[model samples]
Target: MGSDSKQVSKIPKIDLSGLHPSVAGGERWEAAKAEVAAALFSHGCFEAYFPSSSDELREAMFGSALPEMFALPLETKRRLKSDDVYHGYIGQIPHMAYESIAFDDPVSPTAVEEFTKLMWPEGNSSFCKTVEAFAKALHELVEIVQMMIVESLGVEKHYDSLVSSTTYAVRLSEYGVPLNQDTKIALDPHKDPNLVTVVCQSKIDGLEVQTFDGDWVNVDPSPNSLTVMVGQAFQAWSNMRVRAPYHRVRVLGKEKRFSAIFFSRPSHNSMVKSPEELGDEDHPLLFKPFSYTEFVKFLYSEEGRKAKNPFNAYFRIGNEEAA
Candidate 1:
């Protein structure tokens, strides 16, 4: 998805180990918040070091749930379907050796339970528990980052209203080594359509993100860290003040790779609009308020997927319109 021919830099790694809202006015918390804001706006992503997320969670996730779930038969995985676009099992692509399955609203008991039942007809309670707990941890981290971004933009008052209508989807992706020798692009470079995305990568490092200067970055996430990305929805919400990065997975080693990505989005029916504080004389509004659901439908369309600047085509306001 990216060219390593250009200089490869490490994506910004921030230690948000003990962040809390109570310290919002403190220098330490504000410093961390500013770093996060800078990384999101320029690099479009940051590797977060959150100690509260324990090693056991990562072990259980990568050790059992991911391997076991991906081992299931193709037919079994196919049974995990969804009415929503791109929310279900995705596999059988022409070139990519990748397959993924997701549970919408992973934090919801009913949602995870339903997905578990489908994946394991007899009911795999362990998977359900692990998914729920892990998702919750990631959700908390997402909230911290969101709050920081809101505060940085001086729209902290809008935080509660914004998150009140948020929904989440978590997906586990598996990429196997290819038969050929050369490195292969396991996943295409694309920006997610949601507001925020937090990725839990395996010990193996292969994900690459593009920087504002066009350098490709190799992200190596420690057990304590997860890669957090600002998505296209955030671009509209922040009036293009924050960029949604372009990232892709590349596979070279023989070992299989697995990653769990959690997406925080506005509820499907809700509108995504920039806050009043975000639009000003210098930073004009770049998008009209858009429907979270309809925009997803557009990205899944043939035209949307093919465009290099999908948001520019689908939601971005032109210069004249902005003026």
Candidate 2:
């Protein structure tokens, strides 16, 4: 789909350096909260710059491990393929020229080792170690971002229990740019199924977000900046006050693109619902509470794939309440 115009709107940028424990209650922290709140309200996506130490870990994953893995032969990559979406390599699909590897529990050493062995067969300890280290670092950063979102909404105290059971996964994606300008779509438009997604992209930019006015704007990749997108769970939790933007990738030319995306969701048993404090008569709970497991099942189902908003099944607005 073509944009209404060639002009692209820049996503908001928020510095997260002040999130350190040493300055949790300081001025910088409040400023960060305000910036984050505005971004979440308007775009549902924003750029976040963390400390240098965190950037090093991000670089190791996107700069080192990802390229090394994607450079491997297709035959070797196929060895890690699985029917399941939560783990292993997924081959390219129509309208997209990228192959991706998913690590269900990125922070788990055993899981990483098993995944690495599946790819290398013989051995690749360094790959496993690097990914595990990167995953752990990113996980910690995701938690910090989650807390910031909670604080921005003024529901940190109410949402404290939910944070403890959050689940995470990391995916390494490489998109091949098409030679033909006619081949426009790299990825179809859709909202992420998780609570939030933090994406670190390689220098090339193809990621685009659909604005409220129905225009697609490119989200240019920046050095040491991770892009964050609010998702369906966040929208539900906020009683639809927050939104999940629909985004897609458009390959410009023959250049290749890569990204390491970390998705954080509530645990399987955690209920996805609007916080009571955020709902009132004017805006009653818009979505019915759903368990994370149920949502996942629907997310991957045939019907879910066809629906514009797969999470609409959980909507309390016009639909009968769940028994």
Candidate 3:
């Protein structure tokens, strides 16, 4: 019964076996065990470690390429402003949530200022290579997890085939000041509005996740391991059997921490839903069907409407196809 508490101090890890085969190396196997069924109603978090030997390659792929990609001058980054493609780059996005907390409620003025002055700086050739490699490695890991979920549902021999046409985006973020926050650096508390987030970090810590009891749990970085959690779509598909947890970052201490996050998203045009085993008449559909592009646009809109956050709106529950 090795648990998440046994592994790291402040970080919480949802052991996958809680959702898969609970009996380790046991021969008694059902289509999907009872524990797996119950886990669908509980937390969907897990921890994984990559060997240090692979760290160099992972960093080169995910860590390095990000700044290199973002540093191509304002004009160059703007040129890649992920228009309808929804797959390229977002030059400079304003920090809409926490800005108001520090200044006012409609928080985009000074927030945008800080983001412009700070945030991602320049991209380097060597860094881009490392970040890209890490992204690819993490992508493979997500695919593996998806396949297992498909099997657990007792359907779709190849789960990936269902999501083959999807486009997945990964972001490598560096937050706070370089060991100095009183000067010019700060990030707000906001949950990622995506399907799943796999995060890997350096020595510095800043991540916190909400647990079932409505308490914040800190996620510290392991030397070579990445932390993975379920997102909104997965929750919707399961009719909320799987819930998307809330998370935020707090600027602690003063060491500049580098984190590589691979954001796994459905294709802009794909519709997400749960397996027959997980959905029912009661849970029905809970969200409207919309393209990832539309979802993002709505999220960034000034209308100030509260729709489903990225992490809570997956496998929609409405007849959006007719609309």
Candidate 4:
């Protein structure tokens, strides 16, 4: 339950076999259900190992050209500016704007190449085909995991129905050097704005998560593996049963760190209503139906600017205005 150096192993691996209702009723279903329940109730996070091929496809996303792309001078990267959508290169978003989500002193862009702005990298049509295929691959996997989560909760229907088409985003985060400051400059503690984030970190280790008993655990990058995190939207739909874990990227050492985060979110107008069975007197109607676009703008505003944890703002746990 806690992440002491000795107890890090206690973090349970997500049981993928339970992707269907029957999976939870089998001999080991109870154990699987308990594991997921504990993860939801405790740390608000869990790790599921994707196949090696998945990792390979993800690696392909960060093509040989990506390095050069991210390596592009900041001036060039700015050319692909995203207006309201923070899709393009983010220069140096202040700590306050993303305080609830990113903990670094000042969130700065590490790298952005010519191709980083596209949904998928550009090359020949063959490469475009592969990119589309890759997106489907990842989407199917997320669906499987989502169903299992629904089954585990003993809900009447799969949670997928509540979601429309999912919106997936991939970002190549380059945490550049501290710019001569004596103190270490890196991202701060925060939760993601999407539904679920599947992060593929480079060899460099700096990502950390808060444990149930209040200890920081380093979530290292494994060869061809993903670090899965639940996000604000998912937590909102789950009605506080599942939580969005608090995490941050700390750029240790002097070298720049490259991390590729594959963000999976539901469509903008998708409604996040309370699960039928989960609606009770205690839980009640905690969240009104909100579009992800609106949530994004809200997050861009003051309510989203106060804390290092996005879940705090999204869930209105402590903010009186949101309440």
For candidate 1, what is the lDDT? 0.83
lDDT of 4 at 76: 59
Residue range 198-296, candidate 1, lDDT tens digits: 999888877888876666777876878889999888878988778888888777687999998898999968998888888889976666778988898
Sorted on lDDT, highest at the top, how do the candidates line up? Answer: 1, 2, 4, 3
Candidate maximizing TM-score: 1
Q: By lDDT, who's the top model here?
A: 1
Q: Give the range of the ten consecutive residues with the poorest summed lDDT in model 2.
A: 314-323
Candidate 4 local lDDT, 216-307, one digit each (tens)? 67776665455667787877777666777767666657765666565667666666676667778876757776777777777777766765
User: How many clashes would you count in candidate 4?
Assistant: 14
Alpha-carbon local distance difference test for all models: 0.83, 0.74, 0.49, 0.57
| Candidate scoring better on lDDT of 2 and 3 | 2
Candidate 4's displacement at residue 300, Å, is: 1.9
TM-scores for all candidates: the values are: 0.93, 0.86, 0.65, 0.73
lDDT of 2 at 75: 83
**What TM-score does candidate 1 reach?**
0.93
Q: What order do you get sorting by TM-score, best first?
A: 1, 2, 4, 3
Candidate 2's displacement at residue 198, Å, is 0.5
| Model 3 residue 318 distance off true place after TM-score fit, in angstroms | 13
- CA RMSD for every model? 2.6, 3.6, 10.0, 6.8
The digit string of per-residue lDDT tens for model 2 on 47-71 reads: 8886533656656766778888999
